[model samples]
Target: MNIRADIFSRLSRTDAHLFYLPPCPTPPFHSPPPQKRSPLHSRDKSKEKNVLITGTSLNGIGFESARVIAKHANLVIMTGHNSDRLNLAADTIKRELPSANIRPLILDLSSLDAVRKAAGEVNAFPEPLHVLIHNAAAPIGPFKLTVDNLESQVATDHICPFLFTKLVAPKILSARTEHYTPRVIFVSSIGHGIGTGVNFDTLGRPDPTRYVPMEAYYQAKSANVLTAIELSKRSKGQINAYSLHPGGIYTNIMNPASAPKEAVEGLHKLGLLEADGTPRKDATLKTMGQGAATTLVAAFDPRLDDKSGAYLNDCVAANELIGPPSSDPANAERLWNLTEQIIGETFTF
Candidate 1:
């Protein structure tokens, strides 16, 4: 497929550009080129490092991150809501790397209690955690509330992850050494530019009348950026926290069944999807490996050691394109305080 032509045609036709596809060129799916790894990663012994990743569906970014990190991480914990799928992902990774150490932990980020329980279990583990990757997120779904009565998107995207991070922070801190730097990576989206900003007053209140699925998604993603920024500040160089747009990949997050028929058809009309609705095996859409590049770089790159809290895109710091709103310190502080209030915990640091 002619990716450049398809994106251009789509851009010319659509006035509402809420969906995020990176403008950068992508390699074809069948032969995705290898990405560069951090030199620092080669010096580390896999058995000495511990990593955790959320939302590890078989073909998603999280799963890909785990697959790549497995070669360097001693123990990689992959978490998801379904035990069956998590086990399958673990098996798939094992098939490729026979000696890979990976474990599956069930966690529904939409539920606060589940997040807390999962965090507790992880915290009890003796190993010091060196990496935390919040790669799980939902697409625009029907408006609903969790047991905590908070909007599902915000809860899954921000609230629960925030709580889980707080609960497991001590372990992350303990893992840090002069040679090892603990890292936190949040997989955000360029769609964050579409949000109208966080509304603290109506944050958790579920109002069907006021719910706009795309806006809700955008707000939650924006909160991810804010969370990473604030978390980096609080860590004060002890940990590196970064948020990034993982390029436009055709994962389950972009499932046609969950989108408006017109939008789906529009994407299909462009050469982005096949007749069967899967992403075309062309340069138009990124393969899972391509989408996971920025995340892998953020996790292990030594060059990024002092660039904590930066928003990355296309595998480099991209605060300029993400715009001022994402970097606004005021918004980060506000979101941090609001998250603490909602989670009912104080992270003093």
Candidate 2:
């Protein structure tokens, strides 16, 4: 049996096209050709757009996405918990694109109080936000709880982003005009297909017995998709919301070699890992540029304006790739309500 095809077939609940099967190519898929003048300063200053992205660490896709966004946006707010790393990422982008306007902000997504404080800072930015991308994810490890008393993975990956989104929603809405509509993107993963649906019973619980690191990780990723779906429905065309898998890239966060033994063996069987257990060198994986393309597309593609709430892979819409549980509107609503209840806040459109 072809292990890669077999695995993907099972991962995609439907018989439709497989996620990451088309093989994301290496090239700038969404960014335009460089202009004689910087796109940031070449346009009217008042009309220039602003973008905010989380998890701009040096080794992840978030850094790559922020680098690209800085080329076109008036202000690119790059965020992370480490002030030094955040500043380094912003400096690196500025070095590459001398005209890039970058702001380094500290944001820790694990603590509800910290997220609220950071959102307040973001909401106070001089210009309204045109795009918000929740690209941060928790590293998989042993079961742990956050200061907020929730499971570490779900808190960092889903709940904090939800709170931040609700708090900064006004800034996003304020950017909307007759010609321009703001967008929000959640950087989900193909791992989102791991489970049938969000397990509300165990979600946010700190019981170590109930926690399997990778399963919890996938459940949180699925929450990203559900959140996007619900946010779009509630926004009522005022803002665009999307979720995407940034292809199978060999980033620090996705090194199968360092994953669980079963995960490594599975990747080996699927030809995604070499006999020695390192990632295979082929089209099966994407470069940083290719990996970040779908996120860029979800953020700025005018063609997707009407496709809000859709899940994307390889720079195109791929709702068929997600399982029915992740796509069900009722599940989205359920997760939304539970998240609100847990966070002790209510949001209404």
Candidate 3:
């Protein structure tokens, strides 16, 4: 199996019609992509730590990832725009892992100003932050610009997470007070390659080809991967960062509240996924929980401590960016620099 496919299952509605054992000659099923270097598989169970996960409200990747890490982490910080669900999730974790510390923060990530405020709060914590999980992302749906005038997807997925990770970096690195494995995992998606690669010039713009919502999401996700890679390289061993694609989980990814009603209805109508990994013998749809697994593995798995800067799928490291434009380490760096320019600051995270 291709290394990337092992880590992430790329199922697009565009391919839903092709998953079935169709009557026509089953068109060539191409071999999967290659895998990255496998880190030591055994997890270190001796240490207790803190992890911050974003965008986990209800049955999302953030919640699932929290469930996986609660046993190993001393504290888990969760953030989201949905206050009601955020409180509920925090309460559930507290009850489930009575010993684990769970803190909830409500912040709108679409605005860089709000992101800055959130970052400042994290920096003020008396203790160090060992892990920063940037899982929450707004899909490319409406042609909306954030309060910052940046595209919704780019601002939320790229700008907010990148800056937040930077703001928390010093605490994580300076915390020699404890044996810390500092990591930043940005949850990205395969749709990031909606059609092609990122357009450096039109990154935050609102236009036709430039404004295709899902296509924009691909750009932000790509930015996440690039930022993570650049950060890992910059910090050397001081900080570990990653861009991960949690496999297709059946989570209500594009919820009606968060996305268009038609978008959600169209996906249900497509019927391409299975929550349990029963390869959709009929179509390519995935269940919400199934989609959250890869993210959980990356955020909570101890085996990946030394393997920072990885892009993971399922429970393992995956290749660089997926889809058109292919994988290139140099391209990753280029995007990283371009992202920094967009936000007008170096990646201090």
Candidate 4:
């Protein structure tokens, strides 16, 4: 009766078995340009490839992702809602790598105006943006509405990311060259398979009367996968879009004190947590580096170029685990169109 186990069981035996193993360490992060340099090589010196990531609070996957990416990327823009925490995260990265170029941007995903203003700042930057990581997500909670009157979890997890990506995609597109293509990565979760499917009828406007906290979360995560799939299709090789499940890493978001009491108990029953409430110390429970590994793979792995739209786990493609709801192309389009409807804007690409 374990939904996650059932979902994993549906994967090919090889991939399903790998799910219980740690992700293999990757080589150095950089990808050297192809030997046949083009005129664009002259611009590379001035136009250093930049990476922007959201939700980089302390000790979380986002912060770890920024820290790792800053080691090699020319510029790493870290974002969060609180300036103090965002600045601290960036400073921490700088202290670790003295030469690392870390820019902390304040972003509050609950507000549409804030999303627009943040996207404007990213667009105004002089250099091209080579990678965009949607690492922020709403914490598990009861049904609540944002200032925009959308469900808080869905608004933060899906609507805001959708709008921000729409606005900033042009910057990512402009960075494309013969040897380098911009990448868009969504840090989705295996929880995506918890729900039977997304309920487009009431996605943005969830009925608090019938709200289920974890169900809402799963739906939002599924949207992440659908968004990546549709983006890969629409970009038509112009960009690489990928979504992944960063294994269960115990961050503040998952702390029993911060997460709902019911949710914590459910995780225990599911064997995801130890009796004391910490994440279980198994291959399924990853370190911050291991949790961020899939994101890095999706971001820099040349092997993923032809595997765009892939849903990765344990650093390898595992689309079979996403199930028919998330894998259906028509559903992906429907979700795309519904997202536009929710945001009141259409994205052509």
lDDT tens digits by residue: candidate 1, 79-150: 999888989999998998898888889889988899989999999898989889999985566777888999
TM-score of every candidate relative to the true structure: 0.82, 0.83, 0.76, 0.85
Off by more than 4 A, model 2: 1-47, 255-271, 274-277, 281-283
lDDT score, candidate 2 = 0.79
Off by over 4 Å in 1: 1-47, 257-283
lDDT of 3 by residue, 223-291 (tens): 777677778888877877777776555465544555454345434444533333233565544444445
What TM value does model 2 have?
A: 0.83
lDDT of 1: 0.76
Total colliding residue pairs, candidate 2: 0
> For residue 314, what is the lDDT in candidate 4?
67
By descending TM-score, how would the candidates be arranged?
A: 4, 2, 1, 3
lDDT of each: 0.76, 0.79, 0.64, 0.78
Candidate 2 Cα deviation (angstroms), residue 244: 0.5
> Candidate 2 residues 257-281, lDDT tens each?
4455544554565567775568877
Q: Clashing residue pairs in candidate 4, if any?
A: none
